[model samples]
Every structure is written in C-alpha cells, then in structure tokens.
Target: MCQEQKGFTLWFTGLPCSGKSAVADRVAEILRSRNLKVERLDGDIVRKSLCRDLGFSREHRNENIRRVTFVAKLLTRNGVAVLTSFISPYREIRDEARREIGEFIEVYVKCPLEVCMARDVKGMYQKAIKGEIKEFTGISDPYEEPLQPELVLETDKETLEESAQKVINCLKKLGYLDHNF
Candidate 1:
C-alpha cells in the first residue's frame, strides 16, 4: 500500500548570512530524496520576484512576510512541504505566520551577529553598518529572537550537516516525517 505524506512548513528565520538558506536547502534535498514534494521559498529569490516592489522598511518587511505566509499556507494545506528562508526579524510577524499556516515549524537559525557579519560575502553587514543600507536586521534594525522556536540551529557552532539533521529529526519527532526516513 502507498503511504500518503502530510505537508508541513519549515520556516527558517535568522540574520543575514546565518546559514538559513543553506540549511533549508539541505533539508529540502533530504525531503525530496525521500520522495516528498518540496517547495523552497527563499528571501533572495522571492524578493527578485514576488516581493520585488517591497523595500526594507518595517512595513515593507511585514508585507513581504505576509505575502510569503499566504503562499506557504496554500502549499502546506495542499499537502506540499514548503521550506522558507527569510530573516523574518519580528516575533509578531513570525507568530502571525504560525497562526496562518497550521503546520508551521519555526527554525531559529541562531548565529552570533559577529559571526554572521564574518560570513557575509556580499558585504551586506558592512553596508548596513556604514549606514548605506538602512533597516538591516542585526545592524541598523533589530532581529527579535524567537521566544519558543520549534528548533534552534546555532550555525556558528554546528556543522551544516548537523544543523540539517536536527531539523530532520525534529520533523520526524513531530510526526511530520516518517521515522523510517
């Protein structure tokens, strides 16, 4: 008999260059390898398309996440695994997303600001620090840490594989994935 897979949203939130995208990508690969349907909604890619008209201000940022949340909700309820990687710096907005998407799993990609800045190849942190980029999370703006995230991956300390495995383990424990996977 064929087993039906349930869908869930893996929401990865963190500061810039904190390995949110990388870990989410790895998890998506693992999920897909298990023959699960997966869709990845990343900040950079979405901003170039769905959120191109948006800016970095707080209002724009919230609107950007609202739009993503809407898409995720639809995908999740339709039995498609959705992985999203965005800074999503506000706790209220993340909570709102959780409410909107029933199967939301918030993964706090916890990395030190200094470490994230060090990992910045695009010099986004540098630009933000120099006031060239305003309203940048962890620099000019703020990133409110999750009060009770479903998972926390400290990219500053954990290897990519380890962090990805943690997410997989969480999904299995939460019954989002088959334990055999």
Candidate 2:
C-alpha cells in the first residue's frame, strides 16, 4: 500500500534578486521528481495575475501576502506541497501566515543587498536607485529578516544545487519527506 505525502508550505523570503525564486524552483523540481504534488507561487508571476492591482506600499504588500497565504493554506490542507517565493518583508505578516497555515516552513534566502543588486537582470535595483521606482525593498522599503526561520539558504555563498539540497535536507529532517526522498 502507498502512503500519502503530508502537505506543507515552504515559504521562500528575501530581497529582490536574492535567488528566492530560483531556489524555490529547483526545490519544487526535486519534490515533483519524488512524485509529490507541488505548486509554486512566485512573486513576479503572482503579481502579474493575482496581485496585479496591488502596489508596493506596505498595505498592498501585506494584502498580497494575505492572498497568497490563503491560497497556500488551502493547498496545504489538500495535500499539495506549496512552494512560495515572495519578498514578504515583514515578520508580522510572515508570522501570521505561519499561524494560518499550520504546516509552514520559512526558508530565508539570505544574500547581501550588494550581491542582490549585482544579480539583478531586470534593472529593478537601478530603477529604484534612480528614483524611477518607489517602495522597493532593500532600496526604499525595508526587508525585515526572519528572526528564526526554519531554513536559511545563503545564495551568495552556496551554489544553487547546494541550496536546493539544503531545503530538501531540511524537509527530511522535519519529517516532511520520506527517508527515501
């Protein structure tokens, strides 16, 4: 008889260009390879769809996360492994999400601001620096780093594969994944 995989939400949080999405994508691929039902909710993609009307202000940002949290909560309860990549810059909002979603893991994608700026391919940092964009985290807005996240992936110091493995290892250690996975 086959065993049902437990559902959980892996919330990736960091500054822009900090490899949150990249690492989440890699982890999602690995989970899928293990035949787990996975769903990725990336900031940019979700902004273009679910949060298209939202802006970068604190209120809007909080609302954006609220919506994502709701979706994640639903998926998690339904046995889907939900991987979300978002700046989610406030500790309070993240804590709220954790409370709302019983099975939640906060994965802090830790990369220095300078490193993130250097990795920017969209010129978002440049625009924010030039005053072309407003309320940009790590530029104008604040990014409240997690006080005690379940996992921390230092993207600048670690290779993508290493970071991805760290997340997988964390899941296993936390009993989210089977030993064979």
Candidate 3:
C-alpha cells in the first residue's frame, strides 16, 4: 500500500555455500511475518525444476539468471517482493537483471573461498576439488565479485540474523519499507 512496501526484487549473489540462501530465508521470513507478499527463488531449487537441462557453464548460468530475473520482474510487477539467491557470478548478467527489474536491490554475500569450502555442508566444494563436479563456481569455474552492490554481508564474520537485518535495514533506508506498514 505504501511506497516502501510496493514491490521489489532482492537479489542475493555469492559463492555456492556462501550463506546467500541462509540470509535470504531469514529475510523472507521476516518480511512474511509482516504479512507482506513475498517469494524466494532459490538457485538449487530452480536448477532442479526450472532449468534442469542447463549445465554449470557460464552461458548456462547466465541464462538461468535471466530466467530468474524474468520471473522476479513479473512478480514484482504484480506487487510481490521477490527474494532470489543464486551464484550469479557474473557482474554483466546481474547488471542485466538490474536493468530489467527497475526496483532491484543487489546483496553481495561476501565470504572467503576458504570459509565457503569449510562451511560447505553438502561437501560440494570437496567434490568439486576432487573433480567429481565440473564447472563449479570458485573451484573449477570463476565467480566475478560484484563491483558495486546495495549491500555487502560478510557472512563469514556476521551472524545470519545480522546479515538479514542488514538487508532489512537497507530496504528501510532506501524507502523500500513503508514506515506506516
């Protein structure tokens, strides 16, 4: 109803186990608690369902981001807050997304590669390092860090709540959250 609550896409980009989804989940939960319309598009789930045929190549990853951005734009147009977590490693593709979605906020989940490998719960980094997985971001593939973003959460140093709160605070500061709401 208010300008801040109107609709925007929160795009979280980072390495594979870099706490993007964790912060996204927390932010989504907090927004939902306020009875706001919200949806989260997770990379893993989207890969399995929406882009199952796509590989981990740069082209495929860019296409995946494009598809997700399209969906996020549509939802935002319909007055839904879209939260997306992905290893959107390329700045160009993320810039494309930002251009396509007018009300977009890019959140960079900053974590060191070593910390990501150590925090990998699924052992993806181990498998990637062992050559069992191909074209893995930060291992076999490259992850281009965001040149400039709305927020940078040091997931390696900050708690999940703190990271999520940072995003929320940014939204408020940017007038994305209506005070009256």
Point out where model 3 deviates above 4 Å. Answer: 1-4
User: Which parts of model 2 have CA positions greater than 4 angstroms off?
Assistant: none
Index of the highest-TM-score prediction: 2
lDDT of each: 0.94, 0.95, 0.92
lDDT of each residue in 51-117, candidate 1, tens digit only: 9999999999999999999999999998999999999999999999999999999999999989999
Clash count, one per candidate: 0, 0, 1
A best-first ranking of the candidates according to their lDDT comes to: 2, 1, 3
Which residue pairs in model 3 clash with each other? 4-176
Name the best candidate (by lDDT): 2
Candidate 3 lDDT over residue span 1-181, tens digit each:
6544588999999998999999999999999999999999999899999988898788898999999999999999888989999999999999999999999999999999999999887899999999999998999888998888999999889999999889999999988886553
Local lDDT at 163 for model 3? 96
lDDT of 2 by residue, 67-103 (tens): 9999999999999999999999999999999999999
lDDT over C-alpha atoms for residue 131 of model 1:
91
Question: lDDT, candidate 1, residue 111?
Answer: 93
Q: All candidates' TM-scores?
A: 0.98, 0.98, 0.96
Candidate 3 matches the true fold with a TM-score of 0.96
